[model samples]
Target chain A: MSKTLAIGPFNDAERAALSDEFSPVFLAKPDELAGLTDDQRAAATAVAYKGHHAFGAAQMDLLPNVGIVANFGVGYDAIDVHAAAARSIKVTNTPDVLNDDVADLAVAMLLMQCREMEQASAWARSGNWKSKGEYRLNRKASGGTVGIVGLGRIGREIADRLAAFKMDIHYFARSEKTTPGWQYHGDPVSLARAVDFLVIALVGGKDTENFVSAEVIEALGPRGVVVNISRGSTVDEAALLDALENGKIAGAGLDVFLNEPAIDDRFYKLDNVVIQPHQGSGTVETRAAMAKLQRDNIAAHHAGKALLTPVN
Target chain B: MSKTLAIGPFNDAERAALSDEFSPVFLAKPDELAGLTDDQRAAATAVAYKGHHAFGAAQMDLLPNVGIVANFGVGYDAIDVHAAAARSIKVTNTPDVLNDDVADLAVAMLLMQCREMEQASAWARSGNWKSKGEYRLNRKASGGTVGIVGLGRIGREIADRLAAFKMDIHYFARSEKTTPGWQYHGDPVSLARAVDFLVIALVGGKDTENFVSAEVIEALGPRGVVVNISRGSTVDEAALLDALENGKIAGAGLDVFLNEPAIDDRFYKLDNVVIQPHQGSGTVETRAAMAKLQRDNIAAHHAGKALLTPVN
Candidate 1:
């Protein structure tokens, strides 16, 4: 039987599932991969990777016999595809299955920001609604114009949901794709300038770093709300923080931050923003699907089947 | 001027608009209606009413000379429309203008409850995301079955939005509406049993008081989530709370309660519930439109034309 070396920080169910088939060595973190013995590293034919830590050439070179890196998430920015391709190690990601969940979070965050739902919930839960009269009126979210920063599968899903809310949709992508009645922008700044809501759904990587630049944030102006469900590296975080602090834009709804978990402390104090812990694909059902997909890719690679959902 | 006597708690914008069109007396609450001089009461031909305090026959009798009561909101459950009808005094409510806003709120609340967005936002904002590994995964909101309690305009709007989320739509109304492919239940209990999420959008009045009974909550089962954006009287609050406490139902997202502002203290402690002050139509844009419609009704009534949205 071939060994499956699984990476750290999987949930109980995920661990059980991974253990049931091709029981593998588990490393606590990417840093711990170096501590493995020669026999242990050679025994493992496949690697099941998770988390946001960078897995570059240095890390890939450690597992000489490792045939594939099955990433548990759709965003494989943390994985160096160039390094994997150079070493002939196949890289596969779980996508499409998580699109609905991610899109759902994007819409939910945007509504939370526009409707001031978190504050309203707090007000009611704290017995202030009785003492403070009615919750103060908030900005209306429906029937407003929205700009989608990407036109990928997840972005299209988000645009579809917002469309049902009677929102005018505008989008920016690598090239214009024919979508009915939705306005297409040649660039992010123009899209930001045109819509009241700017939602980032761009993919992560080097070419896309700081895709939503300071100029884009400035163009979003006072009434604009920024909702980023894409990678943190895709946007200029310093610019976003500055814009939020000065009310350069109305507020923001953010899931991904430049630094995972240990994000900028400035975000903790702002009342205007709504933050989530990159839980876009964090639902029991979706996570199970993602886990299964990651495992299936590993299973297929061992069977000499073509890699499923391969990025490189 | 026909002397439009405007009643309590109007925002500055509403007050200004009312004053410009009909410069009449402005009383702070229903209790102050008795403080008016006989001449002042007689001079008032139309009353621009606001707030939730009951406008019974007694309050109506205080201003006997008033010909019409133009309510500021869609729900006239606070007003005794039957009494007005018996007295031959016209009653009108601002309706359709607020449907979009109320529908938007309903969807926002449902998504908030399903996604555990309030807790997730708190986790990220409080630096718990850094301290902890990640926000715990929650239930998915999309692709679930939903039951709309009333298939009125607002209910239809909410169902439409949820449909785009790939939700299976089921509803209960006075009679089956000619909707495409949506399952219509003859009663609330049946609707509750058939869906994962049940949303209350019924009109507030004697007819709908305690419509979402204990039986209905029980029928929804442990996997169920209730979302109420209708009147406080529409659902049995004690029953709903009991279900939430005992885990008879999964959770709830409520905007209205039996005693709002001073809602039940138990709600403040519950982790599964999401509460909001009764702000179904509370938006700067929608409120302005509602105020304008209310004024328009009064304006039309004084001009001896048909009331725009008459309840009596």
Candidate 2:
């Protein structure tokens, strides 16, 4: 009888690692938890969770003895912490470890858009450069003003990298941060207006839904580019599409989208946009670290020890 | 009769700028110099050259009165500086102005390859991310060691940017430079062995035709990534392709290729390569700066003043 259920699609190596410590029952999705036999369900003392699926009270009820949910990712928006706390269930998340990878991707996406690297790379591969003369001139990325939509850990990481490129950094958070020479904006609209590139690094969920509104998109103007590495809910997709279509704004380099993998098909046809499948922390080193942290949390829970990074 | 022959396909703005100082005769190529009327040839005191066409003594002879060849780009390998100096023809090139743009592209290409962003972006756009669970895991780029070939001005710029990402900097130059904390290797193979990324920033021409040889490529090994923002001839393309095809070297992010536009078609089919069409300095702001520098040299030559950025 297993004391743990490792939910979500783990790669072969990750699954092997989990099996070493727990007599784990693997479930790729939370919906599958209800389908487990009573014996399997009753035996579970903890859940090592992954994926961006909602894990609420209904799922919690299915595994009554599952005292803790150890999430693989830093963000726990998918897991309802309040619901977990209500059921006397503890929730823990992996944080800080994946910050560099996420921050690296945000800046990479921004550079891709600013320099039009996608088109240039494609042109070279297709043997177009020889026949077509030279790749078209792109805008310079460095030495420009950049606006970050949040100043949390991930946002600060991004700002630090861009600063090395000689960029002037401006950011918006609930309140001001104490970083030297970094300008703080009270609202996102003004931040967008003052900078050439706007990067969104806000936390996911309801409060940040459409945080980058149509007015903010409009304020970004023709020379503006938006780079989003956070959840898709942070930006208004409709307004962003309109701005890109009409050339109201220059371009965007997006990692996450609303209903991703099933993202807006219009993004496919746009040359101005560089769309990446939400892969901020998809690097092998980072993923391995995330998986290890998640396993460590579950190990702690099973031992009746304090969780390494508890959420609720 | 023109006092200057703008010997490349100049844009409307660039041509207008040239006309401000000289009786500009616009030629899209250097070969067209042979077709010029005697009076037009005799009137030309300076040539504002662009493109990668060989402007040897043969081309120089077409304009007997030409005193200066003011090349648009920093690299004057095509201009044959020794040939120009032999004919008592002064050579000047636009340098330093394009350094930041090239450095930015080099780092961007490295990030794109490390994250496998091209395929990931395509998957998101193709609606595969929705159907498929997630993008494949890729290697981490930040906090790794990077080796620079020929740590000149542009190499220094690339090193500075990568350092901000917490990357360890290593380089090979004729003589070790005085950069603090950056390790200098006396040999190319040692440099390649020491770092995950090998960036080529060597000056072009016969002396550097195959500076990154098969030995260095082999030394880089399977985990190594090669980023070339220098001239294509700087690397042994055949050895590079073989390594990439055999999985001997992990991948390449190349901005330059031998016979570019007509480069090896094998590169097109390779998923492990990021082929950029030699657009290192192909940014609007940088190109404008380069054009200004080229014009400044031309202006200096006509005024019997010393050249602004003289090569000989």
TM-score for each model: 0.98, 0.97
Residue pairs of candidate 1 with colliding backbone atoms: A129-B261, A130-B261, A130-B262
lDDT (10s digit) by residue, model 1, range B54-136: 88899888877788999999888888988998888899999888888888888888887888888888887777888877888
lDDT of 2 by residue, B201-311 (tens): 999999999899999999999999999999999999999999999999999999998986688889988999988888899888999999999999999888898889998
Candidate 2 residues A3-98, lDDT tens each? 999899899889999998786999989999878999989898899998888989889989888899999888888898888999899999989889
How high is the DockQ of candidate 2?
A: 0.81
* Candidate 2 CAPRI classification by DockQ: high
Alpha-carbon deviation at A200 in model 2, angstroms:
0.7
- Model 1 spans with C-alpha error above 4 angstroms: none
lDDT of each: 0.90, 0.91
lDDT of 2: 0.91
Calculate DockQ per candidate and list them.
0.85, 0.81
Q: Model 2, residue A172: what's the lDDT?
A: 94
